[model samples]
Target: MKKTPNFKMFMFLMVVFVNTSYSQDVVYSAIFKNVNKTAENLKHHLNTSGDTLYLESKFDLNRIEIIGTDGLKTFAINNITKDIRVPLNSLPMGDYTFAVVQTEGRDDTYIYTKTIVFKISRLLPIDMDISRGITPLNASIYLAGGTIPILDLAENKIITDFPAAMDLASMEDNKPVHLDYTSMESLVALQEKENLDAKHLRTKKIDNILERNKPAYSKAYNITDIRSGNQNIQSRADYRRNNLRPNGLPYD
Candidate 1:
């Protein structure tokens, strides 16, 4: 018996063919050195209050396009100069690829394109807490950013209903804590109390020593002399310190 043609397979093949064809037509050329340099010098500022993405470029931009990770265009601009500020509050929080095309020379002979990827994350205030365990703490936990969620794991299951913030008294004991989010993938638990105290004491000691020796450092560096209003007197003092003659003799 003759087999029937697969309609679903045929539709899938058609979709793939059209997508591949479209992608081939929109190929991105390698970024030119000048354009790449300009992009490297570009400064990006995210203004949360204004909900805008401020971009400052060194060179003239022919086009600026923001493309989602799914290959969909979200925003675009053309014939923009050194400064381009686009509102980004409407866009969802995720990774986005920015394509910048620049032109140079009177005839716009030199064309360059550069692509940069950036992530937009939701701003959430993270609260952390620590408790003492039965054993004396020997290690210290260092937290870099204050945005990771703290989790507790005991019997191979993750505890999510733990308190957002907790106050543990001195000499109190509790179980080890884990991180709920992948942002703290490298971290295992919070620092123990004894270790934390030791670190704080060391930091305090160093700060105190610095404070005590501050006068010596100031005397050795003497940067305040440069800020003095008398330029003529300062110049003469500098010349004398270098043993240069006051008769405008160029020091060899």
Candidate 2:
């Protein structure tokens, strides 16, 4: 017997709900912190074909615009800061200027822009050579870097960080710095010791099994895979049962 809700009342409630929803415009700023001051500009150029320009910055980004002699391209978003992925396949080979803009609280705004030059080219290979010897194995260091990469050819692994401590930009004449062979010798010795320990543990396990099964082997079981138990199905468990004792030498 109550009065039904009318269309006018429903419409009025919806209008109030939409107005009360939370929404705000994006605002942001950025600062460059790299120490290599000799590099003149904040922007860096890339020449890869059909690649994207990943612009990374800390700011509440509203829109980023790329301005070239051809025209202007704008990318807009609602975030405070975001990566602007600019595809370069469509543009002609040349230089361009990019502008990054951000807004805060609907009124505050800021902008950063820089000119970047880029060119397209074929990638070159790198080369390598033995740099120095610190030890027998670990110390033997190799250096490689050229327009053409140096193929290892021997181990089939790309050579990286020869001097170990030096960064790429700090290398003199783009030549790799190798570590000493003394380091290599120590590594080899450690490996040999580990192998010896494993052999010793294996011998002890076989001895223990023989002792336990000797009483049973002479009577019924032949020790030829007598099915020790289902628990021995796992390689690790089998290895332990065949090599270790309840009170034997610690495996490590």
Candidate 3:
């Protein structure tokens, strides 16, 4: 008597064969080889003058395209040399992919494409009011450091020079404030008025603050959580308990 073939084993083998065939079919473009080789020789340097992005390429480029991470093309140029300056004052801060394509060979069949990814960041200084209970005590202490030292917790190194903070106490209440070193002096002055100990002033690493506070910020500002009926009800209850007027009415 012949034994029946193992159906499960046969099915598994068939699946493996199909997957192998599919993987073989996924071939990279021919241009990618030249693109990779040229990319190895190319070097990119990025600098910012006000809102303009100055991109310097070491190797000559046939075409350069700036594509947003979302696959939207923001800028492009053809037959450009090494130095290219792009105005990005209006563009939002985000990651973008730069594609540099070049063609070589007498027949012009050789195509090469290279991609560089980068992010744009902006530092905007705003004035903020420091109301009691509005800002955390530790954060206030950090602000008091005036030229606060930002430590990289992972590397355990100070990144940059201490920035001077200005006292904008006369500004409108509840405005956003960008605290620098001078703010530390203001904080010290406030402490003196309250007769608080100078020893209470402390500095914290930026990484530590971000790591500790990220979860709270995420929870407080999560859109999905805010939209949930249960979360809204819970938030309302918390508000009623935490905010009460002199007449015993909950602050709306």
Candidate 4:
């Protein structure tokens, strides 16, 4: 009636195995880029609040660390696939500087950092046209150092895409039209028709440096800007026609 020694050993082994299985750690990951500039406000949806953030370097696996306002904290992750996505839910609502070492085994490796300013608050109505350019309507829209342009309506309730400049040869067919600001039906329809043309792709391919350093990073493709050479002439024509729609008419 004495307890067997083999049974006691088996129970201890089972406890150790169960403890090891339950102590699984979560990994953090993100990729880095050498591109000169990127979109400032890259917002992401959050599932819950008060999440811990871990920063993993795409170039160096050993450089993974926890980034906080107080200082750096060491952490590990499974992989880093794209731009560094660290949770800022626990941090105060304000500007923050995220800094990390770019390479491992080298102390002189570049210190990469980005400044992000964000606020957790209600949204506001934005005037897209005024954000993009200035036209003959006595209002300004374009700003210095801005690559993209925005066009605003007469009432300024909504904004439109930059007007396409028409050539003199197309002057006969060109006229301004008012469109329903509630929906972007015309732009969407036009995009489906004239999108992905050979001309546009050819222009974009030549202007961007996507095929550099073959065999090293052969699969890597980079795009800075897309230049089609032709202005938005067709878009201007569509706008002019739509603007012609009267307050109550079908196509007015």
Candidate 5:
């Protein structure tokens, strides 16, 4: 296995644009915005405004830390690869800094870390849009909680039936384009308690222009079906229940 390189050698950042004039920062110590070789440090300038916050990396990203301006850690979550989940709705409107940590496979061996910056324009209190009559940027809207909000620059009111509050417009000469960073990769169940799926098909009604024009790219999906799950001991008693926690590796 290839070991991670030293972070000191790659500790500078250059600005990058994903699909717009301005993109969400990734400060990944590279000049080009698109680099795919896993051997090298990989990161993307992701500008998004969806509720399902995630990234485009070949690394096994496992943790996320939401930080404040004074370098105070507000929240930290391990097992982030389960879904690069960041609870955007629960947070109030403000600038937030993210520390996305990637580890070597399933272990605690650290590989690389990067910073992502975004600003939440307006938050409609808790369960009600008590102030929709007032607009922050004239294009502001309210969300009903549950969906993630990455970089909300939406001109229309936000859709409450969906899972993410993605930045869904590209209207201005300098406005950010839809970069498809808001990945709906079958990881999240769109139907939840707060969603209004039973009342109407508001979700299905959403028209993602990029999704429609995009060709069904010929791509194959693969993963280690069976992994030697986390365990310190491997006695004979453990093998009796070796279903998910197979004694050996996925492949010999």
Candidate 6:
């Protein structure tokens, strides 16, 4: 038969496990990128409160100590590496301060970490070789001194050469370009001839309509004089109409 475990000891062990777990979210290293800014100039972030500060720094990889606060002394897991992630959900509920310290010897100096992390596994680009101590923080193109990013991420698709021909007459500026599809020598000449013929026919039709619609009247003249030859007589209306004058002919 097995003996029963101590209840008080079991509870104490549980508390220790919870606190240690919460303290593992913070994994840090000596920030080697970005311009150094003073504490007064740096932007600080907030915690969920009553959280235990479990900063895991380079495990003497870069050698630093931390979690010092205005009211608390934060601790770092000296065995933590550049690969371990800060488990945010495991953080303890507490008040703490964050600072950027210079950590070359043993003091934990935190600056702009210049760090970017992606948690998804196994689906990264094949050219992205962040294994055996390589990481995106040092391999991203957007960062200074970083290596070339994923081979496929270079956007080689749009580099294709599209063979295109451009015509000035088909383009638009402030003054629009109007295109005429009709061939000038053959088609335009035929069109012009057709228009002239149509106009002449229309004019003849109008003249016929006017002649039919006008009022009817008769013209006459009386013989007032006999010619010297006595073969023809002169009529006044006929004389005036038939004669040409300096001022021009009068209306009959």
TM-score of model 2 (CA atoms): 0.24
Full candidate order by TM-score, most accurate first: 1, 5, 3, 2, 4, 6
Q: Pick the TM-score winner.
A: 1
The window of 10 residues in a row where model 3 has the poorest summed lDDT is 25-34
- Tens digits of per-residue lDDT, candidate 4, 128-150, equal 22344312122121221122211
TM-score for all models, in order of appearance: 0.29, 0.24, 0.28, 0.18, 0.28, 0.17
lDDT, candidate 2, 145-202, per-residue tens: 2221222323333233344356557556788767689988998999999999999999
lDDT of 1 by residue, 1-252 (tens): 121254335434644643464323211111112233435756665542223445666666555555554565533333345655453434454434455555443445645655444333222111111221112112112211122221111122212233345566555465567556864643433446567889999999999999988743222223356544433333444555666455877565
Q: Tell me, what's the RMSD of every candidate?
A: 28.8, 25.0, 26.1, 33.9, 32.9, 29.3
Worst 10 residues of 6 by lDDT: 115-124
lDDT of 6 at 25: 26
* Separate clash counts for every candidate: 1, 31, 13, 18, 12, 18
Cα lDDT of model 3 by residue, 1-252, tens digit: 121255335434644643464323211100111234545545443221223344455554455455544465533343335544443333444434455543332345644555554333322111111222222111122322433232232233332445567777775777796889999999989978666443333334555677788744223332245365334233545646676767988777
lDDT of 4 at 85: 34
Instruction: TM-score for candidate 1, please give it.
Output: 0.29
Clashes of 2: 31
For each candidate in the order shown, give its overall lDDT on alpha carbons.
Answer: 0.42, 0.40, 0.41, 0.34, 0.36, 0.33
Q: How many backbone clashes does candidate 1 have?
A: 1
Model 5's C-alpha root-mean-square deviation from the true structure amounts to 32.9
- Write down the lDDT that model 4 would get: 0.34
What ranking of all candidate models by lDDT puts the best one first?
Answer: 1, 3, 2, 5, 4, 6
